[model samples]
Target: MRAKAFDTKVFKRILEYTKPYQWRFNGVIVFAVSLSVFAALRPYLLKQTVDGYLKTHDAKGLLFYVTIMGIVLLMEVFSQFYFVFWANWLGQDIVKDIRIKLFKHMLSFRMKYYDNAPVGQLVTRSVSDIEAIAKIFSQGLFMITSDLMKMGVVMIFMFYMNWKLTWIVIVAMPVLVFITRIFQRKMQLAFEEVRTQIANMNTFVQERVTGMKIVQLFNREAIEADKFSQINDKHNKAWIKTILYNSIFFPIADIISSLTLGIVVLYGGIKILNGDHFTTFGDLFSYTMFIGMLFNPLRQIADKFNEMQMGMIAANRVFDILDTKDQIQDTGIIEAPIFEGNIQFKRVHFSYIENEEIIKGINLEVKAGQTIAIVGATGAGKSTIINLLNRFYEISSGTICIDGKNINEYSLSSIRKQIAVVLQDVFLFADTILNNITLNNPNISREEVILAAKKIGVHEFIMSLPNGYDYNVKERGVMLSSGQRQLIAFLRAYVSNPSILILDEATSSIDTHSEELIQRATEKITMGRTSIVIAHRLATIVNANKIVVMDKGLIVEEGSHFELLNIEGGFYKNLYYSQFLVENNS
Candidate 1:
């Protein structure tokens, strides 16, 4: 839903983007004004040719006037071209800047913000909504300005030709104005509905398309199609409402214009019949043309006004994102070229929601370069610990520190630079394996990436592909198998050479062979760094220096693997025996 009135603040903010390209826009405005003047002069020239040359039988004068009119027509053509070209240029440049800023702003937002905001809505704001704002500059605002100026000049000339006829034309203005007001109001509602429908449609289509495999696999295709049909039906209705309003409004405007034209013709004919010599035929002809010119712009003004209104509505939405304060505040000023990776969690507690603490009053400390493995059941806050360490979500209470300094004392980028996480679900961009590993980091060159991959034992596997390291993973790495993507994720993390490495169930879903390779790669990468392994499989983390077992948001057991296995009925020992029995049976 949109507000009924135009938001001045949003409009003003949109106009501020135009300031950078104001000179180019000024050129466009110059052309627009010239075009308007040229249009007004056309009818005036016709009046002169009709009365001054034709009535007087001056052939030479007629030829000169016609030649001048032809030149004016040529000027109009150039003016029109440059006007459109420069206006579009200005608008495009402004929106380009806007899209870049908006996207960068989106990147800065915290995970919590995205948890609630839909991807499709963000895309609409950045793409379609920005385009709407561009229309305001290129087509709506400037075009309306030119049209109003033309109408003004035409009105002045109409009064000059015949005051009585001008009054008759003026009388029709009220009716046109009334109709335009009604049309604009109705169209505003229609356009708002259309925008909402488009956002909803985008959300539906994006999500469904991304998850189309589930739809087809579950044999819910028909059901989903019906759902889509319902959404599309609403989208259809929204646009149809717009068309219906336009259909009613434009014809009424046309009728009013035609009636005014008729009145001018009738009144002029009667004046001529009454032998009024001053009311010449040429004057009446130009007056009729002027009335047409005036009403034409008046009608167009309504459409342009709607465009501006829509743009304003779009501006409001975009500004809402730009003005969002729900971002990870990078207020920490500490700079770290390298972190020793000494980490501590003291009385730390957190929740994704209020009064539903997932991690409660946990205390742990790890020496630099030590490997610690945390084993837990699902929803036991194993991954939550990693999230908190990364500051992906701020802890609700207590402190988490790195290298004896509060984690918040270092800039997020500075801290993240020294930490790398290989998640269970590996995400790879549609890019060559080399770039995927290096993430296009100039600091980590191709040679460095190859060296890291080779050291981690994935370089040979990567080279086995047709394109070697240059293989394109395609979207979400769908071209690769689950294990291959995991190996790539490992290589990507290894290449970063982070001081702190987090392997969050990295081997959970891979095949046995891939697991062996990953486990070998894991040992090499974690040799001289602080590593935290979140594993469901006890076998994978058997080599970890220390083991912490968590349950129901508290550490139930903590010790070396053998030390914990000796604890009678200990949580870790019981979980280990259970998993061992399962593995043996399988």
Candidate 2:
């Protein structure tokens, strides 16, 4: 993508974040002007000491001027200290605000957004890109402003001292400005490439590390390493391009600055030798200092401008996420703190992709406190049904209702609050088991969790762990076995005391003993609450009040386990017999 020369829109949006810290921003401007004035006054003082005092053979006058210059230096030093401190402080404050906003926006987005976004890319946006934006305040925009003001004041002093010598310095400026302009454009593009490559590397590393077990099990370590090396090389080359441009620009700039100083000295010396009244030794001395002051800020401006450009680019990317319309709109006004556990899907049609329905006109119902079991082959829209019920994805057409009210009419949080789901693959945070079970909900106390665990008959199992309920599960609960994690998930769901409970293949991958515990826990949890159990194991759902067999996205059979088994040609009958035969043979 071609980078914009400057993104004023993005820059303005970033500045909007500074409204809370407007006083600090205004203070930065005040300090910039003060420092510029100080810079100009020092050179003028030096000129006065040289010509006005020393030429008159007045020691007291010279000492007075030197003392005044020393005081100005001290004031300038203090201003600079506060300037640096406040500018950095302002940047960090702004960064903290933007990071919070970005994360909160991501939290509001529907699962559809995360379905396509890489986790590592989001990490880069939140951490690395936001850090680049901080430099805009600490080192980029305000710094450039201060340097420009200093250069301007210094030029005014140079011309006032001796306009003849000032012309020599101005003569070489157009060439330097032209070089800086070229450097800025190239650097912007280079930095853009650098940001993209950094995101790519982050995404690659995050995925590989998260799935390292798969890499080793498949014996693809060499292949994955080669891919990573290629990504690393691209990242290196992108950075080298920026470094190469810096390497070329600074030396040429130094040469121009040195040549300008030499020209002023040569031309002024000739004028002095000719006894021209306009050229004085003091004026020449001040002009040389002025040239150094002038050219140095010009060079530094190039560096600071590069930083501002990077901040603008990073801001643009962050705003893209903030501007996304992928959030599931929470327009429902009705607040139902409790659901009666009645659910109905009326001609519900849905799709993850356009014109490709995943749930084709699904119509089903479960009465209050009924245990309904949905069984189907893989990709038969079984899990999609659960996702739809939880409002993880919006339906394309038709309506879902809980307790005779359209699900969309109920507040999103209220709807989710009443339902708890335990999936086939359980996920637990890297925290103590108690915290994972309660999810840090302040209302679910430790005593209540222990009570729920005891009721579910897993209290003894948890007590056997290193720290009982306080055991740290580690990342994704990898410290525990799969069965152990599932039990924790069961307890997590149980403690919530949700009005509706969903177990989506929760027993598919556990040991027989763990399955028995889950079955008993499931029986207890489903006693008074409506439960929907989606199972691949035929035996597990035999006791469900209603057994619904789905084929593709349509329900092909519905009955009690015995009633379905009595139908010889029925889908559930064949499925149950097949599973039964497999168990008998094994």
Candidate 3:
């Protein structure tokens, strides 16, 4: 099923994340209100300065008035700096917390979710979508709340000065709101479109850059450029839509504002002639200037509404990730999960997608400290079986157990901590050679890392490097060859010394020389552990304590190599004779 968007309930839940920072949030509210009051004070000062001092021709009074107004303005600007600064800081922190939750939840999802989903889309949602929410959390929040407060105070003071003129200004407000909202809706739609296009663009770039060598080899540059052009056009159109709508709204707002000022001049001129209450040259003049300053905050308040709406859309996407509850929940509380290196699958059935089984109702049992080899053709579900055994995907039915305890009964972390996997395509971190071996287990010493490396036959090579154990592998260990990279993967798993081990075609990439070294390492490493090897190389399975030959999701034969070879024309016998005759002869 496609993911669902958030409701108002989700927004409330998201706000609850801020509960821990209530004190900081309260400070922001107080600072924002104070800043707003200080901002509106300048207009009041001008009115008082003009009516009380300038018209009455008191030079020292005007001087004192100017000085106070200057101080207030300076203080307002200063408070604004902190107000914006703290809001931004809080926004970044909130995004970080939300992103962490998203990441953790993503990991909890079943492997099928990742297989079907796009990597670029997930990254953009986690990073950029969350950042969009943060932008509103920061500047947009302070500006909107502060300006709205200023609007309220300005209205009250205007009424106090002149009630009749207040109605004139108030009458034009509905027109401004109407004009403002029309663009606000348009801007929100435009930004939403832009967000979608940006995600698509990210997906395109991700696919292209990650497969750049493939693109060059296949001469697919023209197709990639064409795809990018389409996304770019969509982004351009969304941007133009925003500009076109804003152009209509802001100018109309300005015109309506000018109309209000015109009304003030018209009605107030008559009032002044007739000595109307609160009407004079200085009062009217100062009110007119204040009215002029009102235009920006009004437009900005509308813009903030538009911004918040877009952020809310992005926030909904973020919450979708957080709200997902995968079936693969690990509730086990084992402090030290010590297993006997025995793994059994009892009538296990698994399907990556609904109604299509890749592994169907299979039974297998392994003793502690036994090496089992899984042999199968491609698409025969060998890797899927391994993945399910490791709890990467929950089975459709049946039980996987270690030492007779259901796999689900153990905490995922503890279960995973007891297993180490080295796949055909090995992955390495962008770090020192030593750190790649140890990963997150920080207590590991340099000597221990070297010990694992030596066991895997890469210690001599690493020692020859310029920096030895400290030598950086760069991103994904790109500087290393396939065999060297495979050696590092071996070292990592060896260092973990997990009770259960998985080597999924890990030796498939190595040459004859490297394979010999790897085979020697495997014998040492798999000692005293339940080792499961998925391989096409029949020679490797000759030494396995048990060999299971699978085809079309069922184990057709199982036994030790000699025992299987003695079977009359069975699948394992035929596979061994055809694939490993040379190795057998040698």
Could you tell me the TM-score of candidate 3? 0.94
Q: What TM-score does each of the candidates earn?
A: 0.98, 0.98, 0.94
Q: In the order shown, what is each candidate's alpha-carbon RMSD?
A: 1.2, 1.3, 2.8
Give the worst 10-residue stretch by lDDT in candidate 1.
Answer: 1-10
Give the Cα error of residue 288 in candidate 2, in Å. Answer: 2.7
Model 2: CA > 4 A from native: none
Cα lDDT of model 2 by residue, 425-445, tens digit: 999999999999999999999
lDDT of 3 by residue, 411-519 (tens): 8888888889999998889998888889958778887887777766778878878798888999888888887778778888999879989999988868887787788
**Which is the winner by TM-score between candidate 2 and candidate 3?**
2
Clashes of 3: 0
Q: Rate residue 175 of model 3 by lDDT.
A: 78
Pairs clashing within candidate 2: none
Error of 2 at 90 (Å): 1.4
Candidate 1, residues 101-183, lDDT tens digits: the string is 99999988878888889888888999999999888887788899889888888888778877887898898899999889888
